[model samples]
Target: MPKQPYRFSYLLLTRLLLLWVSATFPAQAQSVYTQETALARDTVPSFKRHLPWLAAGAATVYVGGLVYLNHTWYEKEKTRFHWFNDSHEWKQLDKAGHFWGAFHESRLGADLLRKAGVSEKKAIWYGGALGFVLQTPIEYFDGRSPAYGASFTDIAANTAGSLAVIGQQLAWGELRVLPKYSFHRTPYAPLRPNVLGNGLSEEFLKDYNGHTYWLSVDLAKFLSPTSRFPKWLNPALGYGVEEMVFNDAAANRTLGLHAYRQYYLSVDLNWQAIHTRSKFLKSAFYVLSIFKFPAPALEYNGRQGWKMHGLYF
Candidate 1:
């Protein structure tokens, strides 16, 4: 099986967190009524009383998941600490991915904490830290692995991702720029299954050749409130790569292909901007907000020609 790192850690944690929040919702319902009526919330549900158990359970799951990741990702052989400068690979595209993942995880964790009644400052800080916590454990194991070692660049990128969210929120009290991603099948992916991945599920994570990460900045938020910028529209800047079957330039020469950086200017829909009376629709949009809405784009590559995308995200 091909390696699919980074995907499992966050997806699992988010699901567990959602479950945890859902389970605690009933207990918090009384507080909602109290706030509406200006009355004190005097009764605590039995479930809330046992929340320590839920916390313990969450800890157990996290530990188990980390252990499993270490066992599965690291070989039995012992290896010394080492480092990799993956900044060379994919024309620094993977770094964009690191930032992308870290940003979402940090933001989601913070939002989830807020929903759980954590203080805003604590939620943002803890959520930002959680991104590093989730990502760094793999590095400890990586440092010991002969096949893969800890990369300071990755850690830096992860911190950037987390702090990017924290900084934005602390400054403006809302996210003006959001990290988003989109992908399309590429010929390069099938050529190196062991590294790039063999299937759709694996390829999405491992195939840097196919992934495009974006920073979707809300134009409406940036402009003066009275400006004519559409509130629902976001102008996105994107980073990606082309023809990167190998990590280094020399290897790519053998295939008669040059790996180059691709830059994109695109438009995306800010789904969260949509206002609606239906709670279900709002929740659904929120759930799907992680994805950038597909729209037309124009791209410029490093010494590659200018190109147009009729539908891009």
Candidate 2:
């Protein structure tokens, strides 16, 4: 079966909406901190008056987004609860996306909770599980849709993402290994606009061929604080796929298209590590940390063997 583009679109839209709601509070709260006090402020918890507003706003967006999604994406379909095994689709790139979305969402949830003066233990457990909590319902919706069925692997990926954040917070008290994402325009989207995308915005969500998932490690975090290693630089491994205009192997082969996975060796920027006193910059970096910064990359794929990009997003 061809993969449903709406699934990816729904994830992307929900992620963005949650991020916007989460980010707004921290950005506004930035006005109270000075450079000397910023680090100290983060470590201490004090219940803020705005936490109620934050909770209300997030809840509103969560419910509102679901209502909108059901109306726009699921209303026309005849649906009944069912399970789907899409573990093989899109070379598991969609699973990578699920992991990325859940990781960042969990990270945001924890950060927001911490900022709102929630206890450390509560924040770690609750906020760290936020991504899974948010994404699992969409699977329920999928289960009922004739076009898409609930995927066990998708739930597993979401769980892994949340666990990645939860485990790090419990052990290291901060994230050292980050899951990130990057994208570029691809010609393949025009080949099937309905499934891939029709425009830049839709393409970004639906076109798996243009998407790359990265795992970036902060080397400085492991080294001595006195070490001279650049705090902002990280070594990253990336995974991507190309030539997959159709999710079905037979469908792709009929058109002489073959899908192959690509691996990348690249460097990334740890935006949060960069020193900045500005509250807006701090908030911006926190949000932007989910993206892999453009840099020279070495890529290897079965078809191409090895190739170098001047810069790869």
Candidate 3:
């Protein structure tokens, strides 16, 4: 009985010692496996991830929105407005204005592509192409609306805006461009004439050499939203930092420009354009009244201000 007790104690001690050793040198835990993770979408879907789903959804919504817009206008919903339609004149491809406009649109498209996880080159190309292609469909809808006749010049402007964006990417691919200058609202006081200020900003630049782009952070504030904003808003703001890089060789080269250059910030402001009622027929379909067109905008930067222009949406 005494021998048997000793043997049991020794066995117990050995087991305890083994457990301690195992605890001291633990193995690395295996990563979780899932389709989204395996496909490189940790939490969100990539542009390529679930592409069929997105394609179906985007196509459905885009076409549906167009049809709805037309239907409502046809039914006399009186729910559309164009703040800038009359302010700008149209010039075709030969016009310098066309180039600038298209360049801007391309930049906008590229930015969207980057968020969708596309490579920078693809982003720029896709953005420019999207900017150009999106206009035709929009123009078709406009032509169908009795309240709003399709203007060839307007479609041309859209194309020009997109081309301007592409040109900008080609010229300055280092910084991701944002709307550096734009005006929201109207005269400071409509009763008071000659008040010319209306939310203007300058000293901003974006350059992309296929790999990296640089932007002034301080100025990015008025043009971008914060992280809390919806990802779709694509909020961006910073003071000074190394921007995203797509090419190591291009970023490392010293071309007289600072590895990261700097720019001053300037912005001006004036009156407000307030719309009191829902103008578009689609506005009434919103579950919440807030979704209606011409809903009050308590605070707006120029980017959001662009939404006020019915054609831009």
Candidate 4:
């Protein structure tokens, strides 16, 4: 089966819009701080002023995005509501993209709420669920399209991503494990430009072979406060897929291509840990935090026993 092009484009647009909104608005002054300080900051009258504007902006984007998608994409192939089982598609690489997208969206929602003077408990619960709220509705749009249908697995991945943010906030009062993404151009795209993508920008979202989802662990967080370990350094595990010109195994095999999974062990940078008082730099770091930094990596795949990269993106 071929992949849905609109699905990839929709995800890419949604993420970019959300990132823009997050960067345009001011985030909480500090990324790492005590629970008490967080609560106290919410009491500031000035912070409450942003709540209405933020709410309005978010609502506008939500409705506007759906309208645009409906006209541009869904209208081309309207259908009765249906279900799609894409659990096995793209070697589950698409699922990883969903997880990564939802996680960052949820994180941004929570942080934006905190900045708007919402209480810690409310922000943690309501804001943490924002990613699920934002992404799930698109499944309805998908269900109505003949080219695609509502995917249960996609919903599950979205839910898990939201829970990840909520769980960390409730347990550790901060994010210790961060979901990040990295991409590199691949020759596979040329084989199926219409499906994989035609250019760098499109391939960034549509090319599963180029995508790598990572879980970056903040090791310094577990150490004592006085420990000299670099707080900005982290260890990360990554997952990717390769040699897939088509979603179906048989189709790819007919073309002499075999899909294989890739696992990676690498180092990442904790951009949030770098102390900075500049609001612009802080926002930049918050947006950049969603990506895994390129570093030396060890990789393993069933097709190729083991491999190493001096610097893997």
Best by lDDT: 4
Please, what are the lDDT tens digits per residue for candidate 2 over residues 228-261?
A: 9999999999999999998888889987999999
State the RMSD for candidate 3: 27.8
Between candidates 1 and 4, name the one with more favorable TM-score. Answer: 4
lDDT of 1 by residue, 1-313 (tens): 1123444454455445644444343222111232522322233244345556766776688778777766765657658887755554457776777787677667766765555556778878896676676666666776777766677877898899899988987887778898888877788877877777778876776788788888888888778979998888898898888888887677878988788888899988887777664546555565556567788999998675899999974
lDDT: worst 10-residue window of model 4: 29-38
How large is the C-alpha RMSD of every model relative to the true structure? 4.9, 3.2, 27.8, 2.3
Report the number of the highest-TM-score candidate.
Answer: 4
What are the per-residue Cα lDDT tens digits for candidate 4 across 36-101? 445656545765776678678768876887888889877877889999898878888888888888
- CA lDDT of each prediction against the hidden true structure: 0.69, 0.83, 0.33, 0.84
- For model 4 the TM-score comes to 0.93
Arranged by TM-score with the best first, the candidates are: 4, 2, 1, 3
Q: Give model 1's TM-score versus the native structure.
A: 0.82
Task: Give model 1 RMSD, 1 decimal.
Answer: 4.9
Residue 2 displacement in candidate 4 (angstroms): 3.9
